[model samples]
Target: MKKSLVLLFIIITHQAYSQSVAKYSNEFMNIGVDAAAFGMGNAVVANINDVNSGYWNPAGLIGLEDKQMALMHSSYFANIALYDYAAFAMPIDDRSAWGISLIRFGVDDILNTTQLIDSQGNIDFNRISLFSTADYGITFSYARKLPVQGLNYGINAKVIRRIIGDFASSWGFGFDLGIQFKHKDWKFGLMARDITTTFNTWSIDEDLFSAVSDQIPTQDLPETTEITIPKLQFGVARSFTFSYDYTLTAEVDLNMRFAETNDIISTSFASITPAVGLQFAYTDLVFLRAGVGNFQNENNFGSESLTFQPNIGIGFKYKGIQVDYALTDIGDQSAAVYSNVFSLKIDWSLFR
Candidate 1:
């Protein structure tokens, strides 16, 4: 009865918060890996031996025993091209662990346009072209178990880069901090991402020209512009087991904008999401999971629509090799069809 009440409270509170504001980033990273979505985003506390822990919650790495590695890839709708992530984690000693991860997101075949000017110094024609943009991040992470109790904490420092064809490129840095605790059958976790508001400054090249009496003369043009990416995110999750193989988990997350930036469009409005998921495992080798969150709410669109919902996943393991897959809809216009994503993950550990 207590568990049921707690779950109800989480749902009601999240719904109330979701109505206030709605916006999120790293949408590609949020679809989540296979095993995680199944656990209702409870990975911070649930992950035990998964290599993707580098992305989910680095603090979880503290429990790792052997060197672990994983690769994951997914495809988004409209050929938007999503992220490919790879991570590696190893124990530095009995009390410490270190990890590294790489992620890449790219858009293929984007149309580029250029304005054509006539001798009269007036626009004549528009030229259509094609180009691509890519974003990548490399992360270094470390974690340690606290001596006071069953607590674990970690941090990740990342170097981020963005590229837009041959015209522009920018660089920046960011960080993530996380904590996890587990005792008996109860688990708790929290993580704050993008703690530092980082931005990529681009260097632009411009050729200036002045028109006088139908004659054009070239002039000096300043090159470069600075654009900032605001940072904010906080997530918490808890889980309880009903038996050895059956478990339920709940997660709540809040995303806020930096006070320094107030532009509505430029600023990501604060939003909250809460989710519930169920897991069924058979002898720990095979598992099935499902979850639902932010379904039919106005902040995400309207109460009549569902954004994140009905996620399902499966996993299989043999020896030290693990494979997982998940399917989910991330609230796109064509979510029922094109917005769906298929994810694949592979994990290998040298020791059990």
Candidate 2:
């Protein structure tokens, strides 16, 4: 490669991977999944106590005593996009458990505008069509509790797929590792996401995309290949009971991305994001939660990025069934910024 051209390519790559651009592979994998987790500022790494743990820290499933399942749905970015998740867990033995989970996110019935032009350079409304852009994943998890009570470990293997109308698609595979330890009334958790590094291989219909490019020759899309960066999260949680039947749990978590300033991995950290959450429960039946999330932009307001958002949620349980709801204030970017999340959890043993 020529020296000058190589320099240009390097610059472009760095800009594309910048925190603001975030053109990361399988980016959808990072979606804040369930209502309970989202309610706690996505800081459930150590506070997970339900089947939804399959998506956060699978090790949290080691204590399961009954067959459990959960379902969650969210209307993100107002009502323009939809996100759904479901998971089922079964105890394999006295101290071992397995779970399967699926997540799907999509923007449905999107009008395809590329083919809106007619042969006569005149307006033709019929040329426009509707299509969907979707992303999905399937995960298998296994967790085991060590002979030393309260010590557990888990691993997850997952397959991911993304589709953009009928023009492009990508498939990816990745693994996650987690460890959890509890002593007295405190819990500690560690999770390594994408331990083996996720790879997304894209297939684009050259002819179809070329047609769109020809419509406007000034700009073109970049290559579709992608490699996701690995990140680590650590969390601690503690509960305090004040009254006879009321208890409060507090949690703190730190997320670190192992990338350098140039978006390259190294010993140095690219960013360290911190979050805090609090949950109040009444006799383990009704719960209220609130938290703050994504404050990484606070240090760099000049970047035109959002600072942080407030999360609020409430849930109740009856007869071995749990229901949860969460509302996230996504700043003033748009009236549709608020996100609504709902989730339901059930223990099959209750019926048996």
Candidate 3:
């Protein structure tokens, strides 16, 4: 009874806090995957491992006892197709480990347009430019077991690139720092990512323009737009075992972005999300899992004006290989019903 009440209080507090900072950028990269599974519950950062850890919490590498490699991909309802992620991790010794990862988010065939008018009062057709947009990041990571029993610390550096049509693109760099501690039955985790701000500039060419009206001739104009990524994410989670094979866990996350006076957009908004999950393991050979997340408003659309109110997922494991899948709804739009994600993971180690 008391425990249930405490859980309720925590959920309410987390929901209120999350509403305060609902506006942020690079949402495609941040939305995450392993739906139906990770989405069903609030994505708890501390427990993350496998390939997703490259994007969630780098410190999780400390808990990995073996060499691991993983990949994940998803196709959203719209014509949008997400690419894949791959990661490899190996322990140097009992106390230290190192890893590398690659993540790619891609979109297919977008229509290209140019500002032009023909003599017959008709629009001039510019050659169709079938191009795609991609966001790729390469990351290097290291983690060490701390002197304090179950405590671990780690960091990761990432080089990021964004490519649009022939007209625009950008490159940037960032870093993430993380720590985790476990005592008895309690666990805690923290992560600070995207420590550096990145930007991209585009130059318009004069040849791409044509005459518009009688007096005004279309001229290519050069302009630059800069996007500032968010910084710092904090998470905490707890797990309890009800039986030898059944366990329940809860997790919460907070993303913080300090506002800059010189920036056109303010970063005062923050997002607080909480998640709960159930895991059932059968004789260590097979496992079943389910989780749900962000049950508060369940309808509030943040920066994208797209509501991502709920998510669910499942996973299976055999020997050293594991597979996971998730489904999500990014709200229904006039053009399409948006959401979907899939993931695969593998871990191998030569123990001493």
TM-scores of the models, in the given order? 0.69, 0.86, 0.72
CA-lDDT, candidates in order: 0.55, 0.76, 0.56
Which stretches of model 3 miss by more than 4 angstroms?
1-25, 33-37, 40-42, 113-126, 198-230, 257-278, 285-308, 330-338, 349-352
Q: Ten residues in a row with the worst lDDT in model 3?
A: 211-220
lDDT (10s digit) by residue, model 2, range 1-352? 1233224323432333233223355656787677877788888899785677788898988878899999998876557778889899988998889999999988888666665666676767777777777889999999999888789999999898877777667788889998899999999998888988877776867676655554423233434666777878899999999877999999999877766432112246466767788899999899999987666333244554445667889999888899999988645432226888999999987797
The backbone clash count of each candidate, in order, is: 2, 0, 22
lDDT of 2: 0.76
Q: Which stretches of candidate 2 lie above 4 Å from their native place?
A: 1-23, 120-123, 216-219, 260-268, 298-306, 330-336
lDDT of 3: 0.56
| Alpha carbon lDDT at 255, candidate 1 | 38
Model 1 pairs whose backbones collide: 112-129, 296-305
Q: Is candidate 1 or candidate 3 better by TM-score?
A: 3
Off by over 4 Å in 1: 1-35, 38-49, 111-130, 207-270, 294-308, 330-352
Tell how far residue 107 is off in model 2, in angstroms. 0.6
Put down candidate 1 lDDT per residue, 143-261, tens digits, no spaces: 99998587888888878766656544656666777777777655566666666644444453322112121221121111233223343334555556656765544455443444322
